[model samples]
Target: MNRYLLAGAAAAALALGAGAANAQAKFDVKVGGDAYFEAGYVDQDVDSGLRSTEFRNRMRINIIPSAKADNGLEYGARMRLRANSGASNTRTTDADRAYIFAQGTFGQVRMGVSNSFNDETYVTASMDYLKLGAYDDVTAWINLPSSTAGTVTGNSILNPSIAPDANSTKIVYFSPRMAGLQLGASYTPRNDSSNTDISRSKPTGTLAGTSNGIYQDMVEVGANYNNTFGGVTVKASAGYMWGRAVDDVVGSNYKDLNAWQLGANVGYAGFTLGGSYIDYGKSGQNERTGVFTETTRNWTVGAQYTTGPIVVGANYKNGKDAGSLGTTGDRELQVYEIGVGYTVAPGLTLQAQYDYFDLDNDASAADDKGNVVLVRSILAF
Candidate 1:
């Protein structure tokens, strides 16, 4: 049944585009992309056999084909291909976004692999010094314990929202903005299925005290506000996500997903102040005896000043989650960050950042503190 629904949606979208095409105006194809190269140095308490320096780079291309109908409705499709995965110089490419969209006075509708409404429009702290859309680059530079991976919430402890949907096939709707407010919603059949894959098997939980994060029938609703009152600009976002957990085994007691996000920003006189809170209250943890469960959450606050071609910013982040399934409690992560960026030319930038981080682990031996410095060059067109 779910597969048929997806097929029908694809057919309908193609038909709409075909029937609405204007012979006088052909489809317009455009190409654009961005690239970055970075080098980093790290000093930490646990650096045994770990290299203090590393270099990394990535590139991506966005292919867009769009057209407008005679009645002012616009239709389009976009695919983003990236070369971001490499091990020992072996590189591979993959598409992270592929979607069909149509927009009119009613706003926009997207079908296929795309972000949720909240992921697309949520307002957060202004991070001008960070590269592109990155918020948790520190994770890539530091070694957090492997046991810190799962909480059934955000992709990582530093991520600010619940987006376990993982770019799976979905349908999203965005209402037209009115009086500085906009509303949106999205539905995903399964969090693990994407692209051309069709999954029909029902997910089942492990026995007793084990936990799993996979979910089905994910739904999200969100709203955002954007307005400028006199010399001050105000922006805010709120969102909620919920889903059904895997079917439990005879002795297992698994919890469903329930996560929410709130963020706000205010900017004036070239300075911006903002903060965000994300909460996942034991959303995907097992509740049986002998299993440790805790609230999964993170919050961030920051301020930045932009003057001419230079930008300076700083922020503090705190994240906590349930550690190992055994007797340990929550693990905490804290980071104090400061950074700067300078535009060398139109589409070119040079950036430098320094981060001081402390990790309080459930296991005493895994706890560590570190300082890192990174230099980067970015080009976009």
Candidate 2:
């Protein structure tokens, strides 16, 4: 959509509905998204016989609906729609978050599926939003490095207390910010077929844990803290989740997953520097947990400098998979990228980036290395 036309249409809608109910009064509606196109060309030893050109693209739209009142009771929801060329044939409604929340001195409590509590801290050190660009649970453990493997066990349908899904069909609570301290929790019930009536036993894998024949749902709790000392900001976050997994499916025993992360950022003049560390937990049962008991760690250290309308940045990430069930081997991957961006207008920008990655000891097959070039046009208001 044309940026100007989209803005104009939203403004007109607000003008037409200016006198609606006070509680339902419309505020400014912002519309914008971005598209990224990338192409890669690689060369290898002639005898190696490996050559190819890969094209990949993605488009994402982020929408936010917000409202305010004279008394300061605020409410809103955040939405995201994404399209990818790699997964061209797949389509699903991936709701990021939806909640009716209020903000005040006491804090904010949201009633709906939203970001988990443990996922909130490390705002300053987290470059996933701008640096490494990968923000899943594995990456969430950058600093603290817990003992649990970063995998979810069991289905809530089979065992209500152990469901692994994080985003939708759940209720979450977030406490207001107090001296940079934030707390949150979320719960989901077992409302599926596997939970109500199960006839078969689940598989007893090498690392399945106590997930033998359970049939209850689950909950997660987290705490985050951010503080500034001298000139640097420090962040720490942790969370614990326990649930049941049936036999062939997920059993009745309790399986635990824990995650902890720490991050720090320093700014001086036009330069910013930051990094993060994460650790996954181990399974409790000897037979059902060792496959995932190996500790995996991921981290990124990045720096960026912005001046006027231009910004240049680069990042390095190290990913490791240690501790496997079999005698196969360990897996490791390293990624590096450098990019530059320029703002052409208030809501439009252009960016160019180059990325390189290498994977060794891949459990699937041969080793691999590649380079990628990307060009993007972004519109955000």
Candidate 3:
């Protein structure tokens, strides 16, 4: 009898393992990622002379699991593991983005750390090269002095030419595409919120009469349209964002921040052209008097041509009052880049880019101009 009992237990264990394996087979799961390696030489002529050659590498892995229920509802989750060799000391190689979504006839609802609707729907004329074209350019080669703060370094033009609050923890909804049009909306409880869950308790222990953070309770709405007429394809998008003040630092003088953007792209016969304009509204606050200070604006225009395995692109961007905290007269950046990309294999591409940047400030006599040349290898699978 004891021997028979042992045999029964072994059969049960095998049955349970088979059941679990069959259940897992019902869902589709995929693993993929990309790796990017870049080497560059930078030449600078800012307030002083600087030259450097650098090499950097970044890798990310994406795990995507999805299932389609019998009722026609599809659900999935995406998680990314990211690591970079050239990141700052504070940067961590961890799960940088994780999100889950459900979709069917009612469109898609995504929750967790993801890009806002404005950042998702807004169009740009820049090319999607290895470095994202105008988005990165060559601003890293130049360092401009801060106008308001004492000798603080400033960023390049690309950082300001786009909307703030890129990827944050939020809930987003996207409507189904209808007649070449789609709508999206997102709400974020806090601008600085990262991969953490929303906090129930209000943060404390800040300086008296000052706000806890720059922005809170943000809302973004956007629309995008894409269609092909004749032999040309056209895409356009517009977005608006608003955020409530975290505190009444400036009392009644404080107003909710607002921003908007417009962009369009046209493609024809292996050539694509596009442009975008963004307004970041009023984000600056006077530390001494706690008053709203300055507004920011950015614009870019670019074009690309693709033939077989080679792609070439060029773009120019301008930013005004890029340093939101600085006086209006002390913040302006202009940048331009030209690049070429060649596909070497099914999942590999090589690219070379040349970038130039200029920083101008009426309040400062320092010259901030620089250039960078970069070559990159990208592998995606």
Candidate 4:
């Protein structure tokens, strides 16, 4: 079946299931969303033009419809879309997210571009998960090319070593909760319009000759676990990713590019402490032939406390990268950040965060430092 068409059919089935419950009664639609303004500032020593104000951040709208069927089938789908892009803080867009799923004894099977199983693995039960502090550059860092071809060297300050692109369809299955452990997984096709395949590897001929097919093909997997003993709650997770480079003329230049991460969080009496570590392997590329093996790793420790309607948190992140990707510097980066968040009401949050980036190079020619600040508000239903 056509994937998009199949997804549509699934959504229709859910709507039908929900409507059947109202055949003998009246049903009302439930609607929700949030709109907010943001301001941001960046201090990069090299490129001053990137520094700006009130860069349009995000204007959001969301909706969901759900109903119980006479046959015991409960069905629903959540829809979200952005109305604008950029200006308020950093660059963000008004986009849409939709999902269709059915609940069963085993669990729930969701279809559409939703959160992948790999994504569920690292997030903890901490309040920061719902805040901007999640994946704050200062706390979580990785080693990757400066710009694909090794023109620069540093941590993934402005970007992540691996990030999912939009419209990337995934199938996620959530298992029944068992002693605080939840397992899940997702599979994505090698060729999808949303397949970004952005990677550190580049087409050798492009920089030196021509531009052709050069994209990364890959798969990812992860798991999540949480348990409570008495008054103490603990959460932990691990994940792995692997991909191949299709260099077109050069064909598959590398067989494997792999990475993994481990994280943990502990909470007690309205206070929580968290830490994590991530490493990207140096298994691919012919470093001997000028394509150097690059690796990145980092560790973070932070805490959060909540009182009444207010929550506050602060974190310290330390990052480092080694091996030269054709850069004259030591190929290392370090960063730190602190953040604060507040909950005004159920499902409504306001947050402000600031972080600094320091690119330390063994060579003197590279631009070695920068800073960033972000403030945001979100309404999730």
Top candidate by lDDT: 1
Please provide the root mean square deviation of candidate 3 (C-alpha atoms, Å).
10.8
- Give the true-structure RMSD of model 1: 2.8
* Top-down TM-score ranking: 1, 3, 4, 2
Candidate of highest TM-score: 1
lDDT of each: 0.84, 0.48, 0.66, 0.54
User: For every model shown, what is its TM-score relative to the native structure?
Assistant: 0.93, 0.64, 0.82, 0.71
Error of 2 at 182 (Å): 3.6
Off by over 4 Å in 4: 1-30, 50-55, 84-96, 124-134, 137-146, 149-167, 195-217, 247-252, 282-288, 319-324, 328-331, 345-348, 361-364, 370-381
> Which residue pairs of candidate 1 clash?
none
User: What is the overall TM-score of model 2 with all chains considered together?
Assistant: 0.64
Score residue 181 of candidate 2 by CA lDDT. 77
> Which 10 successive residues of model 1 have the least lDDT summed?
1-10
lDDT of 4: 0.54
Off by over 4 Å in 2: 1-35, 40-51, 62-66, 69-71, 84-94, 124-166, 188-255, 283-293, 322-327, 362-365
Candidate 1: tens digits of C-alpha lDDT, residues 1-381: 544554465455446545655767678999999999999999999889899999999999999999888867788899999995657766888898899888877678888899988989887789899999688878889877766325563377888766778578888878889999999878888888889999977667777545677788888889999999999999999999988887867766777888899999999999999989998877768878778878889999999999999999999989888877674588899999999999999999999999999999888788999999999999999
Model 3 regions more than 4 Å off = 1-25, 47-50, 85-91, 130-134, 144-163, 201-213, 250-255, 284-292, 322-328, 362-365
The CA-based lDDT of model 2 is what?
A: 0.48
lDDT of 1: 0.84
